[model samples]
Target: MDTTGWLATQRDDGETVGYLEPLSGDYSLVQARNLLGHPVGGPTEFLEAEELLIDRGISELAERWSLRDAPEELDGGVVILEASPDGIVVAHADLAKAGVYGRRVHVPWPDVDLLLSRETPAARET
Candidate 1:
């Protein structure tokens, strides 16, 4: 149930958000709920997003940095991030962005590598 992974992502600035989650296995966007400390629903790239967080430590990274609320488009990814040594503040939303008022998943840097969305982010960027 508990494990670790990684998501090597390049920010809009071309910076790296590496080493994020500690949850192992590739989960769907719904499984992202596990790493994100939240729940996810349909049409969301849960597994894809989860893997990236696991690999990049994007969730634990958020614990160390102050992040801006990237546009709440509710796409299938982490939209906002502020940099830190541990990782980066990864802001993710479901496809519909349909959780709460914010609908954002905050993954602490250390645990991001464990997320399920790793490959999706890679394919997206490439």
Candidate 2:
């Protein structure tokens, strides 16, 4: 299990900022979050997180969504992919032809929580 520390950033008004997983141990959370938007104005703690999308098991989601590398038109709906430590390696079928696949979409862990309706850990590199 990856024990990387992630700073859950939020605004002073309680609006969620995002999650910051520093690439190094000596990183400054204040500076990173400040550049992204604002300084983390909330509690800082270490939490063990896990990736929601595992390698396999339940592949299809009622034809409404599919994995990133799944075949095109497999579900006839949105295909969700995640960013690796480097970036997005594969993209949805529709997005591939548009020349936008493989591009990393930087998203906060909180926003991802809302999307998946549950908090998930950052996908760690094997």
Candidate 3:
């Protein structure tokens, strides 16, 4: 398989990241997310936006709305990544909604963006 072409997401199966050590490869959906926002250390979950759109989420008793049942117009984007340190980043148009407290990714102190990505350990690199 052309590992270089795969996105950071496709490269990961809950363990290893699609790591190209040279860092010359173009950005995929996942790499783009990593570059544009906060860092996502190690393995993480990658969910299609449509998948989440269909799930029923909790809301006030007086208010009930199903992401799946919402009008077609409500659904957008190809994917949503739950990255480490960055939380839930809704990526679209090369932009993501970061700074949300929805999730967490272990980062290098306050300056996460500067942390370099290394190949995960053999045991964890699935």
Candidate 4:
């Protein structure tokens, strides 16, 4: 995405966990998006937003997700194997089973409908 004015938040090891976009005065919007590119946090104080991302870490991105209207070849739940500004790489969850693996698909960032896996606690609550 166009992160023109966004500030990167990093963990102790210098891994970028997320970004903070400055809003009004001291308020900022957190960009700790899921695999679907949906923000997990809303507008809040800049420090609060930063802390949220730090506390959340990058583990949130490892959650399972399902692609909406995906091709028939990819017929089941997937996990984000890799992600970058360019795109994301996902593999069928079935492939990860029994230590058997298969090809991964590269999808444009934020272009596909990536819903949190229904099995996730957050999705269950919603």
TM for every model, in the order presented, reads 0.24, 0.27, 0.16, 0.73
Candidate 3 residue runs with Cα over 4 Å from true position: 1-74, 93-126
Write model 2 residue lDDT over 21-77, tens digit each, in one string.
554564432222221222233323222111111221123221223233335433222
Q: Going through the candidates in order, what is the number of backbone clashes in each?
A: 59, 1, 4, 0
Write the number of the candidate with greater lDDT, choosing between 1 and 4.
4
Task: Please state the error at residue 121 of candidate 1 in Å.
Answer: 8.1
lDDT of model number 4: 0.63
Worst 10-residue stretch by lDDT in candidate 4? 110-119
Clash count, predicted structure 4: 0
The lDDT ranking, best first, is 4, 1, 2, 3
lDDT tens per residue, model 4, 1-126: 555566667879998777666565444444454333556576677778777877878775566667666567666666677876667787776676645547677877654344334346565345
Q: What value of lDDT does candidate 1 attain over all alpha carbons? A: 0.39
RMSDs, each prediction? 13.6, 14.6, 17.7, 4.0
lDDT of each: 0.39, 0.33, 0.28, 0.63
What tens digits encode model 3's per-residue C-alpha lDDT throughout 13-46?
A: 3432222112243321232223223233322233
Best by TM-score: 4
TM-score of 2: 0.27
